[model samples]
Each structure stands twice: as structure tokens, then as C-alpha cells.
Target: MATKSLASCIFCKIIKGEIPSFKLIETETSYSFLDIGPVAKGHALVIPKYHAAKLHDLPDEYFADTLSVAKKIAIAQGLENYNILQNNGRIAHQEVDHVHFHVIPKPAASDEEGLVVGWPAKKPEMSELKALHEELLEKLG
Candidate 1:
């Protein structure tokens, strides 16, 4: 079945050639292009041709293809270290509704321009952790 495109989505427009982009890679089911607002020098965005607002909404094949293209781009850029970031919803800082993956190349661990993640580790009750794990497992099934 052919997936419907989102007329108002910028990524959809780019895929349709309605908008111009500095394309990096074009695959059978995905498209990669340079990010206009890049955090690093070789920052790129890979997105599926199908219009999916959330990552889970994408077909399995589309999701796989998107990641494959992202990996290819990373290799081509000679990126030994990089970050693959996917934001699902607004709360996760996903400004764009279309599902896309960010491939950001990092030169060093101290590179301020690259992804800086902070982990505030807390000791949670075993019951809480087990409950969350069970919920996720149920959803996965």
C-alpha cells in the first residue's frame, strides 16, 4: 500500500522536490540531507519517504531503511564517533512532526558542539523498576 504524504510537512515537501535541500544521500525508502540548523560540521538528517509523525508509526521497513541510510552517511563522512538521535514527540524536543533521525558527527568527547547528554542517576525502588519493565514488556508483545 502506498503511504499518504503530509501536504503541510516540510520534510514531505523536501522529499517531493517542492523545497530545496542540501541532500547527502538518497535511498530506496529514505532521504538524507544536511541540517540547516546543525550542531556540528557534518550534521545530517535522515527521514523516511513515508509521512510518519512518530517513529512508532512508521512501517518496519521504512524505519530500517532510514537507519541504514543514516549509517551509510556516517561512514561516508568518516565519522568514527557520532550520535543518532530520534525525537518522537514535542516533549522530547521534536520540533518537526515528521519522523527524522539526526546523524551528528563528533570529533572528540570534549567537543562542545556535539551532543551533550546529562544523566541524573537516581536510586529507584525495585518495585517501581519492575513495574515499569513489565509495562514495557507487555507493550512490546
Candidate 2:
């Protein structure tokens, strides 16, 4: 569970205007701010104005608007490609409890910066894969 953590979270301060931010864009539903401690050159975080611990906690309308705002920021910022990342639980590396989307601009295959994704190879057998897929579908439903 996400307790109210306004005491030390920088993101909370950004929402409250207690700290300054290099905000690139803002909307009625969301706000896009540059990450001062960034992983890439144009690293930014898009967040809903209303505090929510996770993405799923937000209303569908708000989620859709957040994506739209993110796309606008990407275009205005000259980001040809980008990634939208939202973490949920603490085990998923969610440092901040508020609902935020990481808008990491994909480098032009030259800067060699952006979200690096990889996983150890574990080729599951066809039967195993099929069973797991079915289980996931049922769980999702």
C-alpha cells in the first residue's frame, strides 16, 4: 500500500510547487516535467495532477489524456521515438508512489541512451507456453 509520503518525495513537492521543475508541458489532467537527475538527455516524467499510487488507480479518461499529453510533448520536444514507462508496486522499482509515466526519448541509435531492456533466455516448450498463456488470459479476464 502507498502511504502518504509527502515528507520526502521530490515528485510530491513538484506537484505541490514546493520545489521547482523544468516542466515541458502541463495539462488539465497531467503535467510533464524534465527529470533533473535524468538517465537520458530528454528524460521526462508525465504525471496526473490528481495523486494516485499507480496507473491502474487512475480513471480511464485520465490515463488516455496522459498518453495524449505525452505524445504532444514528444512531438514538441523533437523526440522522434520514445518509451512510456509506468511502474506499480515497490517490487517493480516504483520509488515514488504517485502515478507517473517516464517519457524516455529513444536516442537516434547514436547516443546509446534510453531504457535498456533485456532478459535471460529461457525458451519454454510449446506446451508450457500454451498453458501459461491460457492461465494468463483467465487471470486477466
How far residue 1's Cα lies from its native spot in candidate 1, in Å, is 7.3
Which candidate achieves the best lDDT against the true structure?
1
Residue pairs of candidate 2 with colliding backbone atoms: none
Regions of candidate 1 where Cα sits further than 4 Å from its true position: none
Would you give me the overall lDDT of model 1?
A: 0.90
Q: What lDDT would each prediction earn against the true structure?
A: 0.90, 0.79
As a whole number from 0 to 100, the lDDT of residue 25 in candidate 2 is 79
Please write out the lDDT profile of model 2 over residues 1-141, one tens digit for every residue: 222445566676786678899978776777789988677888888987767788777766678878888788788779877888889999988988888888888876655788776568998899999999999999999
Give the lowest summed-lDDT range of ten residues in model 1: 111-120
Q: Per-residue CA lDDT of candidate 1, range 1-141, in tens?
A: 376689999999998889999998887788899999998998999999989999888888897788889999999999999999999898888999999999998888895887887778999999999999999999999
**lDDT score for candidate 2 against the true structure:** 0.79
What RMSD does each model have against the real structure? 1.6, 3.7
Error of 1 at 60 (Å): 1.3
